[model samples]
Target: MLPFVEYAAKGEHTASIIWLHGLGDSGEGFLPIAQELKLPDDLGVRFIFPHAPEQAVTINGGMVMRAWYDIKSLDLDNRADESGVKASAKAVEALIQAELDKGIAGERIILAGFSQGGVIALHLAPRLAFKVGGVMALSTYMCAPQKLVDEAVQPDLNIFMAHGSHDPVVSMSAGQLARDTLQHQGYQVSWQDYPMEHQVCYEELVAIREWLMATLS
Candidate 1:
C-alpha cells in the first residue's frame, strides 16, 4: 500500500487529482502547489499526494533513500533507473484504483507530478485502463522513452509537459524527448520551456492553471 497526503475541496467530489512528488521528498511536499491552484470552489476537486516507498538508491550508490525505485547508477550520461520505473508504475496503478473506489471516474481525474513525480506521471498516464482527464508533468522526463509505445495501456490522453532550460538535475533534453516521443505516437501534447533551473516558475504555474481550467472545466 502507498501512503498519501490528501486535500479535499469543499462540497461533494466532482473531480480529483493524484499528485506524485520527486525523489527524496514526501507526499506533503507538493500539497502547497495544490492549494495554490485553488481548484474551483464549487468543482470539488480532491488532490491526493502519494509518497514513494523508502529504499536504497542504486543511483545514489545504495544509499538509503526515499525513492520510487532503485537507480543503478548516478552517471547523468547513463542514468536509467529500471527498478524505480517499475515500482513507481505499480504504485500509480494502485493509486488510480483507490480513487476509482471513491467513485471518481478516470476521465474526471488528473495525474500530475514534479521532477521524479513527473517521470512517474508520464510513464503511467498512458497505461491506465481508462482515459484520464489529462496529465501535467513539471520539470521532469520520461524514464524510458523507447518503451512508451509498447507499454502504454490506455488511449490518447492529453499531456502537458514543462521544463526549465537551466535545469541542472534533469536536462531540458529529457522533456523535449518526451514531447517528441508522445507526438510521434499521435498523442496530444503541450510542451513548454522556461528560463530557469530544476524547479517550477510562476509562469509555469500560470500555464498549468490555465490548462487545468481548460481541460477539467
Candidate 2:
C-alpha cells in the first residue's frame, strides 16, 4: 500500500477523501488544507493524503523528487510521461482499494488533487472499475486526453475543476481544455477560476467545502 498521512473522521469513518499533492511535495503538504476545510464533524470524513514515489523528473534537471510522473517538457501534450503516469495511477488505485477494504463504499470515496496530483486524479477516476463519489481537480490538466473517450468506464462522473487565471505551472487554458473535454464526454463538471497564481485561495476553499458537503451528504 502507498504510504499516506491521514486525518481520522471526527465521528465514525463513514466516508473518505483521498487527496494527492503536487510535484516535489509529500502527503503532509496538504494536511493543513484538509484541516482548513473544517468540514462538519457529523459528515464523518476521513482525509487521506498519499505520498508519491520518488523519481527523477526530467524537467527538473533529472533531479529525484516525489512526483506523480516525469515532466519531459512544458508543452501540454508532452508534459506527462505515459508509463510513469500509469504506474502512479496504479499506486493510487491501491490507496482507493485500501479505503474500500475498510468498508467505505466506492460511492462514498472522493478523489482530489492539485497540479501533477490532479492529473492522476483525472486520469484514474474515469477508468476505475468502480465508481467514486466525485473528483476535485485544482490547478491541473488532463494527460492523454485523446484516449479518454475510449478508456472511460464512468461516463457520468461528478467533477469539480478549478484553476488560477494566472497560473504559470499549469496554464489556465489547459485546465479549461480539460473541463471542455470532460463536458464534451458528458461528465458533470463544475468549473471555477480565480485571479490568483498556481495555488489555492480562500474563496476556492469555501467553494470546495460546500462541494464536499453536498457530495458526501
Candidate 3:
C-alpha cells in the first residue's frame, strides 16, 4: 500500500476523503489544508493523504521525485506518462479498496488531488466499480477524455475543478478545457477560478469546504 497519513473523524469514520498531492510532494503536503478546513466534528469525515511513489521525472531533468506520473513535456496533451499514470491509478485503487475493507461505502469516499494528483483522480474515479462520492481537481488538466465515456460506470459523478487565472505551470486554459470536455461528455462539474497562480487560495478553500459539507451531509 502507498504510504499515507490519516486524520481521524471526530467519532466514527462514516466518510473518507483520499487526497493526493501534486508532483514532487508527499502525503504530508496537504495535511495543513485538511486541518484548515476544520470540518464540523459531526461530519465524521476521515481524511487520508497518500504519498505518491518516487520516480524519475523527465520534465525535472530526470530528477527523482514523488510524482503520480513522469511528465515528459510541458504540453498538456503530450506531457503525461501514460504507463506511469496507469500504475499509480492502480495504487490509488488499492487505497480505495482499503477504505472499503474498513467499511466505508464506495459512495461515501471521495477522491481529490492537486496538479498531477488531480490527473490521476479524474482518471480513475469514473472507472471504479462503485460510484465514488466525488472528484476534486485543482490546478490540473484532464487526460484521455476519449476513454472516460466508454469506461465510466457513473459518467455524471460530481466533479469540482478549480484553477488559477495566471497559472504558468498548468495554465488556466488547460483547466477550462478539462471542464468543457467533462461537461460536453455529460459529467456534472462545478468550475471555479481565482486570480492567483498554480496554487490554492482562500476563496477556493471556502468553496471546497462548502462542497465537502454538501457532499457529506
> What's each prediction's TM-score?
0.94, 0.99, 0.97
* True-vs-predicted CA distance for residue 130, candidate 1, Å: 1.3
Residue-wise C-alpha lDDT for candidate 3, range 1-217, written one tens digit per residue? 9999988888877999999999988989898887899899888899999999888888889999999998888887788788888999999999999989999998889999999999999888877878899999999988776676676777568999999999999999988988887887788999999999989999999999999999988
Model 2: worst 10 consecutive residues (lDDT sum): 150-159
lDDT at position 33, candidate 1? 88
* Candidate ranking (TM-score, best to worst): 2, 3, 1
* Global CA lDDT computed for model 3: 0.89
Clashing pairs in 3: none
Question: Which candidate wins on lDDT?
Answer: 2
Top model by TM-score, which number? 2
Model 3: weakest 10-residue lDDT segment is 146-155
lDDT of 1 by residue, 127-153 (tens): 777888999998887777888889887
List the candidate 2 regions with Cα displacement exceeding 4 Å.
none
lDDT of each: 0.83, 0.94, 0.89
**Candidates ranked by lDDT:** 2, 3, 1
